[model samples]
Target chain A: MALAKVYVNYKQSILNPEAEAVHKALKRLGYGDIEDVKLGKYFELTIADGKSKAEMDKEINQVCDKLLANYNMENYHYELVETEAAQ
Target chain B: MALAKVYVNYKQSILNPEAEAVHKALKRLGYGDIEDVKLGKYFELTIADGKSKAEMDKEINQVCDKLLANYNMENYHYELVETEAAQ
Candidate 1:
């Protein structure tokens, strides 16, 4: 099987309210040394066997573009790892 | 400076409705080969200098326990990478 570990985050130019809230809370909680915090999404996708590496890569990109990420506000990057499937 | 790249995910035994919804959507969208999907949170923490690695590690754990994750439903893991701060 192939596993796609995806990380999706907002564009740096975009304002992220969630991250701001967390940063404020962290400072209030005495973690002032936390210079900055950016929050994002992580996805683990397990792909079925039988596909070649190139095919899986293309599919993963498609999935990220179509569902896993909002291209206008967010950007996504993924690491594709091959793993053995249990019989 | 140090960057903490944190990944938080639900325990395997727990059910994730969001992931399930995405899986269903993917299948409907003709990505039937997607065997499974797990959703999680990603956090990028930029830490200020002046702290030792051990101190930073402890602080990060505390932060995770108190803010970044819910032990009841999720778990977190992180990679600490050293980086040069912009002067």
Candidate 2:
């Protein structure tokens, strides 16, 4: 099996309220050294076997676009890692 | 600057409604081959310089405990990568 670990975050041009709130809180809590904090969603997907890397990538992108991320507000990127099923 | 990519996910023993909902939706969308889907929060933190890795790790853990993750219901882990300040 293959696993795709996806990270989705708001576009840099967009204002992320959640991140801003957290950043302010961090500063208030005396974490003044933290330059920035960007918050996002992380997803772990277990992909079935027998697909080429290219095919899997395509499927992953389709999933991200169709179900996972809101493209107007967020951008997503993923890293694929192979996994072995228990014998 | 140093970057810490934190991933916070609910413990396996706990029931995650968000993941369950997404899993069901994926199946409805014809992604039956996806064995499972786990959702979590990803945080990108920009840490200031002049701190050793050990010091940063300790501070990261403190921040995670106090502000980021709910230790009672969720578990958090992170990978630290050194980043050069933009010239």
- Each candidate's DockQ: 0.94, 0.89
Question: In lDDT terms, which candidate is top?
Answer: 1
TM-score of chain A of 1: 0.95
Q: Which ten residues in a row have the lowest lDDT in candidate 1 chain B?
A: B78-87
Output the TM-score of candidate 2.
0.95
lDDT of 1: 0.93
Give the residue spans of candidate 2 off by over 4 A.
Answer: none
Task: Give the per-residue lDDT digits (tens) of candidate 1, residues B1-87.
Answer: 899999999998999999999999999999999989999999999999999999999999999999999999999999999998721
Chain A structural similarity (TM-score) per candidate?
0.95, 0.93
Query: Over 4 Å off in model 1, which ranges?
Result: none
The residue-by-residue lDDT of candidate 1 on A1-87, one tens digit each, is 888899999998999999999999999999998999999999999999999999999999998999999999999999998888721
